[model samples]
Target: MDLDEARKLWHPEPGWLNTASYGLPAEPTWTALQEALAQWRVGRNAIELWNESAERSRAAFARLVGVPAGDVAIGSTVSQLLAPVAAALPPGARVVVPEVEFISNLFPWLAQAERGVEVRTVPLEKLVDAIDDGTDLVAFSLVQSADGRIAPYDEIVAAARAHGALVSVDATQGCGWLPFDARRADAVVVGAYKWLTAPRGVALGYLAPGLRDRMRPDAAGWFAGGDPNGSYYGPPLRLADDARRFDISPAWFCYVGAAPALELVAEIGVPAIRDHDVALANRFLDGLGRPPGESAIVTVDVPGAEEKLERAGVRAAVRAGRVRASFHVYSSEEDVDLALNALAG
Candidate 1:
């Protein structure tokens, strides 16, 4: 979809600019959720009806990330999806991550400490150089959530490959507005609420064939089976042959809400959305007399900026002691000016 076409489908009030914390749902996503809830409230449809939406969301996520549908696993959260990868690590495996990385991508590896797993946290700028022969995995967010710095993806991947280490990316803060291809990493995980515009309970994960083979499907249930509908009562212990084996039981309502949002993102196309978001972010920065920023999320150190924004009815976030303003598909140049005017006042 074109930018204007996609913009009209969302309903964010003017001056809303907090997509970094959570997404504002589009009209289609809201409608799908309401319809699903209405059916549930009256018991008008079977619970299995909800399952289809999860599968649809999984496929849509796969398309957005440029991966085969079978290579994507449906999940409820980033940490939950990363568990198997952490479990599969050998005792004393060394993982490297950015010091200020979002906890979802860091905690899972840190939790492996009792198993002799060692997590090395370094500054984001040094992440690529941090990978060496001893590093077993290099995990980091594609975009920093606190300040919106895009990772040096090519350098990081090259460094990891040179050392025979695996690369895992948390795309939670980057996906919908950042153009990326999941094939570039060993594993890519996305918590879609922030930018894909889904509800809070859904996540999408991509596992390379080798990574999936190393990881155990410890969380596997009927949902992970090759035929979930038939595997409910299995003694056969059937699991999907690919990444679906890593699937967790889905949150029905979340998927019902996620499908349309994921589909909408795929239809709008990330490159176009990235242009729209970054242009607005640049507009905001220009008005502030600052250099243009590449990422859609911008952070500034104006004193009391957070309080100023709040007082002006401008929705944004305070992260790591800076006022973070994020633009998305729904944001416009007007939203950018509103925030700039608030900071000026």
Candidate 2:
């Protein structure tokens, strides 16, 4: 795919490289959101319309993440989805997580400690070995949000499988730029604002068939049960037999935007996008004369890092005394050159 073609979809000034923090939504996504809002204003958007939109959005997400549409649950945030998944575990169960994971992925499991659940916090390097026979669940981010270090999820998944432990992944940081199967884990949760290139307040959770069957929904609402009239009224609440049982009411407008975002990803194809992003990241690394890390984000220690990037007309995050330049389909050779030169100076 021509990078210029992808770049035309967003309104970023030339050389924006901060997709890891916030994505510039494609023009079509914006159009979809506006069209939904127009329908709402004109009284043309019935609950049925919104429900159909939700299903389409869910299916699009399933396609992007390599999961069956039936296994996908809709939520508004990672924390919203993670809490119930954590609560559903048996009391006093043992759970393991990485010490340096994004806090959204860490705190929910940590909260399980009040129930006498053993939460083992290990460094990323030791996360795979941390799972043992006693572990009931193992949760970690696919890509570390801070340093962009990709987790060795295959090893962790293998370890979890050997020990009969369930696995959950916080895939928000890696979902769009990196390709992987969400079904590999028992559950994978994502907030769509970042790399998914959608509006905020839309999140996705995928529950494997076995895990969905074994764990009951902890956050049951009327929508989770899939009522035909699309009514939010249920006297005796009945939950869904599938992953929809865990879903919460979504922002309808957000779903409108999200569907198109996934469509763009599917059109360009994830494997190609991954190759493009990794290549851009590698170029940045090579320009800096540094070794490549696992994913599209490349970080280097620098003084006044954020200001340097800003002066170079690049957008990135500088944290922990390191400058992190993240690439996506829209990033180009010019962006990397500017970032490398600014960092070097």
Candidate 3:
């Protein structure tokens, strides 16, 4: 689907500028969720019906990031999925992260300090230069949550590779509207609620073959079993042979809603979404007398901007003492104008 056709899938209000916080669900996604809830209310079919949604979402996300579905894993949150990696790190290993990185990517490595694993916090610009033989892992957000500054993906990945450091990216802020090839990093994780527009319980990740071999599936359950249907109760400890081994037992209804949302994103295409969102962001930037920014999420230091937008019925957020207004494929020129007018007023 083209941008024009895909824009019809959502019905966002005229002044919603908070896709960076959480995305409003598309019509098909909302409908899929409502149907699943209704079915649950009456016990309509079975778990298999809901489970199919997880598989569909998994395959769709895999296509969006250019990796095999078998290489992707399902989980509830970024930190939860990364806990095993943190635990498995050899004692005294050093990890490099940006000082402003969201805690989901930071806390996991910070927790490793008990074992003498050093977690180095550098400015985003210095993050690439920080990688050396001493750095065992380079972990960060692809897009900063506070200011929307995009990370230097290719540079950081290259530096990590040159130093033999594993790269872990929290793409939660960048994925749905940004084109990413997950294979570039050892582990690329996303919580789909914000930009992918899935339910809160949906998180997806790609784990490279080499990295998958190193981490245990700490949250594994029946879903992680080699034969989930046959191994309802544990005994032989049979887990999946691929990245599926890292799976966390899913929240069924969440996956039901996620399937249609992620599939629609795939149909519309990430490169197209990137163009649509960034164009709106640049328009907002132009109105604010600032140059265009690469990210759909933009931050400005207008005093009382949050309160001003609130009075005008335009929804936005304040982060790091700046108003963070994010655009999405569903956002409109009218929405951008409303926000601009509110701030100017």
Candidate 4:
């Protein structure tokens, strides 16, 4: 594929570079949004419209990650899907997670401590070590948002399974930029804004077959009862048999806005996108001539170094630093060079 043409379709705006974070998909997603909005204006019930969009979105996500559509659920955020998984854990069972996981992955399990569940923080290197027979659940991010370290997911999943533990992955940072093997995870959750080039307030969750029924829906609503017919006359509600069990009617406009973005990604292929990102990251790394934190990212070696960086106004100043580029299909070698040159100065 022509990189430039492909980029044009993948990026919505020119010169608004995004190296510190990933950019959403551009043209195709915008088109999908318009179509979804038009459909919504016809006075369709919000729940019905969301569920219909959810079906299409799920199918697209399943195809991207190589899973069955039945395993996918539309969610508003990663935390929303994870809340149920945390709620369903056996009382007093230990949940293991990396020490530096994003807040979305950390707080939900910590909340479970009130229910007698034990939350254990293990170093990234010791995540596998923390998973033993006593561990009932293990959760981690596929890519650490701070340093951008991609975890060895297959190994982690295998270790968790050996200990009779279920595994959940937060793919928010990695989903659109990296290729994921869904069969290796018990469940995977992602927010579309970061890498999929979609609008915020849109996300997807995938529950392995048979595992959907195991999760207690923390945000269960009438729609989750599986009656798209608008009839709520069912016995004390059971979560839907499919991943829809996690569905809460999300904002229809946001869902519509996200569709084109994901479709653009689908067209380009994730592996191609991953290759593009890795290449760009390599360029940034090589230009720094050492690990990040020295020339780029403005990080320092201090106690709570990461926390200090955030407090120092990193996100706002991200574009002014040596590492001022963003990750997107349209990001260019020239952009990488410019970031490197700024850091070299």
Best by lDDT: 1
- lDDT value for candidate 3? 0.91
Which residues of candidate 4, in runs, are more than 4 Å off? 1-4, 10-22, 34-51, 232-239, 291-326
Segments in model 1 whose C-alpha atoms lie over 4 Å from true places? none
lDDT of 4 by residue, 1-345 (tens): 545568866544333345335465476667767666766689556555555665667778888888888788888889988888888887897989999888899998999887799989988888987799999889999877665567888889999988889989998878887887977898899888877777888889888876666777777776676664553665666667788777887667777767666766777788888777777656666675645421111221233423433443323123212233345576667665654444444
Task: Report the C-alpha lDDT of model 2 over 1-345, residue by residue, as the tens digit.
Answer: 464587678776777888888777899888988888888999884666666767887998899988889899998989888887788888899999888778888788888888888888899999888889999999999998888989998999999999999999999989887888888899999988888888888899898888776766766777787663554674776677788988887788888888888778877887888888899999998887778766888788767768887887878987556887889877788888888888777
Better of 1 and 2 by TM-score: 1
Off by over 4 Å in 3: none
Give the alpha carbon lDDT tens digit for every residue of 84-155 in model 3. 888889999999999998989999999988899999999999999889999999999999999999999999
> What are the runs in model 2 whose C-alpha is more than 4 Å off?
1-4, 42-47, 228-231
lDDT of 1 by residue, 96-200 (tens): 999998999999999999999999999999888889999999999999999999998989999999999999999999999898888989999999899999999
Better of 2 and 3 by TM-score: 3
For candidate 3, what is the TM-score? 0.98
Q: Rank the candidates by TM-score, best first.
A: 3, 1, 2, 4
Report, for every candidate in turn, its global Cα lDDT versus the true structure: 0.92, 0.84, 0.91, 0.71
Report the Cα lDDT for residue 61, model 2. Answer: 88
lDDT score, candidate 4, position 284: 61
Ranking by lDDT: 1, 3, 2, 4
TM-score of each: 0.98, 0.94, 0.98, 0.83
